[model samples]
Target: MNGMTDAIALALAAVLMAGAPLVLATLGETLTEKAGIINLSLDGSILLAAMAAFAVSATFDSPWLGVAAGMAVGAAMAGALGVIGIYLGQSQLAVGFILTLLARDLAYFLGHGFSRQPGPDLGVWTIPGLGEVALIGPVFGPIFGSRSPVVHLSLAAIFLCWWWMYRTEGGIRLRAVGESPRAAFGRGIRVRLVRLCYCLAGGALVGMAGAAYSLAVKPGWGRPQGCEGAGWIVLAIVIFGGWHPVRAALGAFFFAALQVSGIYLQDIFPSIPAPVFQVAPFPMMILTLLAANLGRAGRVQDMIRRHPFLKRLSQGWSIDPPAALGQDFDPRKGL
Candidate 1:
């Protein structure tokens, strides 16, 4: 029983560690989207930021500095995208796609020297009293303790973002900018400025996630880091989570479960190819997104409405992207 408990506790800890980056990325994207922008360059942004973080940390011998540098890189990339899309009225998707490719290549080029180099590692701080508990201790210890502060930070961010988005007046205004820019403008809100600010802030978080990968989670830079496709996964998670911060964090954990399960299965079934399990999460994520969207289907919604409890569940699954998401707002036109 003790062994089983240990195994379960360790597994949960690993999942939290793995899911931490996804949580940050998903939340960042959610923030961007909530501001009526889509930073499709997330993949590139994460890679470049990771590379920058690794390089900076290696130079400064400080993980925190690396994290900050990474955030700056991410914010700059996002700011450029926001500027072009919001100010110039270019297609955000096209610009974002182009930037992704560029960013990826740049990371590969500039990070060539930093590849496989050791950098400062984030120390795990385990809480003394809580970490000493029997079963729950091991589980929550790492979360609150010193194993990786990123987990705690990620958890804190989810709650903070949730409250800011749902409970505050500023949050309501932010939502209005995304959901109805024209209405927001009519209400004396500065749509473009708000969108730009949130987009940059979101990008900063995404960048921090990139740093979390190198300095904390994986700890070191690789020529082509294994985290290449994580950005896309995070995008799927946002949809799976219905663009809500808490749900998105849960989705991150869900993916982490699938990821850890794949690894565990590989160990259990030695005959199976590792890549088979490694790629399993992608398809599973798609299925999850499809399931999450089921409530949006007319027939399914009708069925849900027939039952009160079912309707509540359906509502939970329903996805309502900001009304003006991806739409340009021109202050000159008062839109």
Candidate 2:
């Protein structure tokens, strides 16, 4: 490959690798939201899971075991949130936020000894026949390669989630619960139970995202960790993606591209402050959120739709959060 082509190829590969974690986390959050629950503790969940995955893998010398441990931790944390916030009638947002802080500290403290230590990782795997293809091999090969099977897993997750949320009978019920729990309840669906189930399941996926970071993307754990605020960014990608699994995956890829862009730019502009590139995605995402939500009002949306340029720019930018999202439900009370 030519220099430019190679640079582009590597950049895209980096995107798939970096975005894998966000893809998992975004999908997890999307599933929870689809069931009318918000897993705000995702930020901490990722941190704790990463620590658990790395620490356990280092100790046991088994990456798969570490992944299992990470998923268990994530599921347990999310289950606690469901039982307390959903069943006990506490604020899910408050509980989730507190959990993030606590998990962050716990990961740091408990994982102190494991920092900077080497651990098991999914090394690269080139396809037997396909890896020989001149063009396709280099681009698609790395995604499914053993170095990071999470890329393939993330794609599978997106497909499965999209199918589950739209193509099946159970999916319709899931949406009904989020859109209108009362309506779902009237149809004999257990709203609270569905929400709790999805919440726990979503947390498990988020936990796996953490393991993907340690075992596949970054390898091991240490200070100055880049995984700390990734959960928040993943959450933003969910909103930026309009809560659709596929769109959210695209958003994750886009965000990862931006991160890669910062690195690419550093080579051309070495004088620029490094932190500027690091933090650029944040404001960009905030602006994207503004663009999306600003057109939600009736008149504004209608006006934007009528103008060619404005309509084009505002395409797919509107707010449609689940109808009964975050609202406590009582099946016996009829709402």
Candidate 3:
């Protein structure tokens, strides 16, 4: 019993650490989407940022500098998306797809020299008193108390984003722009500027996530960077989470749990091919996404409406995308 408890605790800790990058990336995309922009270059952006972060850190021997470099790269990529897609009225999907391919190749070519290289490590920091508490500390301490600053940042971002979106004036305006740019413009909001700002901010967060991968989570730079498909996963998680910061974060952790389980399952069933375990999570997450959306079915809606308790539960589970997502807004045209 004690051994099982210990194993579970360790697993939880691993999940938190492993999920931090995903959490940041998901939140970033959620913010961008909430502003009516879709930065689909996440996969490539993360890869490029990871390479830049690792290269910079290895060169300067400073993780902080590496993080900054990663953010710059991410913002640059996002800014391009905003300028071309949002301002110039190009197809967001096409521009983003091209940028992703460009960034991926850039990362591979530029980062080739730095592959498998050592970089400055961002070590862990344990809170002073949390682990010393009497009854619960023994269990919760390792799970939450001791962790890298990146993990703490990821945790803090969840609540901070939730508060910004639900409890602040700016958040209200941002949501308004996403729902209807014309409506937001009539109400005196700077629709284009707001969208652009949020897009850059979101991109910065995504870049930081890339830094977290090379500096903390995976701890090296290499081809097949082990995070190849992470950006797409982050994008899906944002949709699965209904564009809510907290729920999106939960989705990240859930995916992380799936990854950790894959490792354990490999040991339990050695006959199964390793690639099968690795690819399983993607399909499983897609299924979960389908299940989550079932609440939108007419019959499900009717059943929930018939019961007050179920209706209330359904309200929390329902998915709602911003009405103007992926559309361009032109201030000159009064739209």
Largest TM-score belongs to which candidate?
A: 3
Q: How accurate locally is residue 250 in candidate 3, as Cα lDDT from 0 to 100?
A: 96
Q: Could you give me the TM-score of model 2 versus the true structure?
A: 0.93
**lDDT-based ranking:** 3, 1, 2
lDDT of 2 by residue, 1-335 (tens): 56766667667778888998889999999999888888889989998999999889999999888988888888888998999988898998999999999999999999999999888976665556665679787665544444467877887899999999999988898899899898889889998999999999999999999998888988989976688789998888888888788998998988888888998888889999998998998788778777777788899878987899888766654457888888889776655
Better of 1 and 2 by lDDT: 1
Ranked by TM-score from best down, the candidates are 3, 1, 2
lDDT of 3 by residue, 1-335 (tens): 86887898899989999899999999999999999999999999999999999999999999989999998898889999999998899999999989989999999999999998777867787888887899988888878887987889999999999999999999998899999999999989999999999999999999999999988998889988988999999988998899999999999999999999999999999999999999999999999998888888999889989999998986886578999999988888754
Give, for candidate 3, the lowest lDDT window spanning 10 residues. Answer: 311-320
Pairing residues by index, what is the TM-score of model 1? 0.96
**lDDT for each candidate structure:** 0.89, 0.86, 0.91
Please, what is the TM-score per model? 0.96, 0.93, 0.97
Model 1: per-residue Cα lDDT at residue 197 = 95
Q: Which portions of model 3 miss their true places by more than 4 Å?
A: none
Taking the candidates one at a time, how many backbone clashes does each contain? 8, 3, 0
Error of 3 at 259 (Å): 0.7
